[model samples]
Target: MTLEQARAALAAARRVAVLTGAGVSAESGIPTFRNAQTGHWARFRPEDLASPEAYRRDPKMVWEWYAGRYRNVTHAQPNEGHHLLAWLERDKGDGFFLATQNVDGLHARAGSERLVELHGNLSTARCEACGTVAPLPEPNTFTPPPTCPVCGARMRPNIVWFGEFLPELALEAATRAFEKADVALIVGTSGQVYPAAGLALETRRAGGVVIEVNPDETELTPYMSYSVRDVASRGLAALMGEG
Candidate 1:
């Protein structure tokens, strides 16, 4: 469908569900996890740094790596794509639900209220033993292998590690949104990740219209009713009649 058609569909739809990925934040200069710099983190694969085994073996190294990422995301501002979604939520009210695979807090910073963060946020830290969670400490300084003051157990960034399950609440929320949506707008994701990728299919299976916005064809392309091969920020803006 054309941009005009998409806009009309969006304007007329009662329930819309949106899913985003790293490509959305890439516009804001946040490096994708797989694209870490060759000099510093290239030596250590993301899988190595983002696993329970790695944290168990060398928590300090994992902490240091995540600390750098946290700092980067804290410094980067949300881009047009984030603001566009926020605006959609503000104008469309409860009919719109957004779920993101990005760990950066860009969607929150952009003022998206009804959002589901499937990958978990990078701005929070949690105690491993007691499950006490808190915003990352000030001065952002953590003694390598940080310890929780509340329980004296190790502190780790509250993210879903490689081998970890996606947060149950987030998964449930996204699934519910998918099941209820009349239109599902999937953006920026390659649609390769399990569960998140499964959303597009779920929506289609439930008889919802699926619209995909990305710069390239994704695994969801075949299932989409409309595939717009363009930058997400631009495509979404156009689709929302803001361009």
Candidate 2:
């Protein structure tokens, strides 16, 4: 469909739900986790660094890798896609929700209040001993990463690892959001991951419009009601009647 048609669909959508991925943050120059390893980390695979087992075996190494990522996230600004979605959420009030797979906290930084971070936020750390979550200390604030103040247990990045399931509450909220949405904006995702990919299918089955924004065709391309072949920021801008 044309840009006009997509815009019209968005304009008519009262309960809009958006699903974003790493591509949105890529617009802000933040490297996706799979591509972030560099310099001394060039030899280690992502799976080797992001798993719970990895953290258990070498907490210092894993923490160092995520510290580098946190620095990048702290410096990265939200792009056009993030701003426009925040605007849409504000305009729709309680009728809007954003469910994102990214752990960078960019959506929260973008001023999206009604958002669910499915993968958890990388900027926060959870106490492995007590499960209390807290913001990671600023760079240079700690020597070997901060331990939990309450229990003195090591703090791990509050991110879902390979073996961990998505946070139950966030997943439930996302599911409910899709159920109530009149339009589903699937942006920047490859549509290959399960559960998240199922959201798009759920929207389609529920008779909601599925608008996909990506630079290339994805696994869900065939199911999209309106597919815009552009990068997340540009495509979302055009859909919102900007670019």
Please tell me which predicted candidate would have the highest lDDT against the true structure. Answer: 2
RMSD of 2: 1.3
What would the per-residue lDDT of candidate 2 be over residues 59-105, giving only the tens digit for each residue?
99888888888878888899988998998998899999999999899
Q: Candidate 1 — worst ten consecutive residues by lDDT sum?
A: 137-146
Stretches of candidate 1 exceeding 4 Å from the true structure: 139-146
Candidate 2 has its poorest 10 consecutive residues by lDDT at 137-146
lDDT of 1 by residue, 2-43 (tens): 667767877888899999998899999999887854567888
Q: Which pairs of residues clash in candidate 1, taking residues 3 or more apart in a chain or in different chains?
A: none
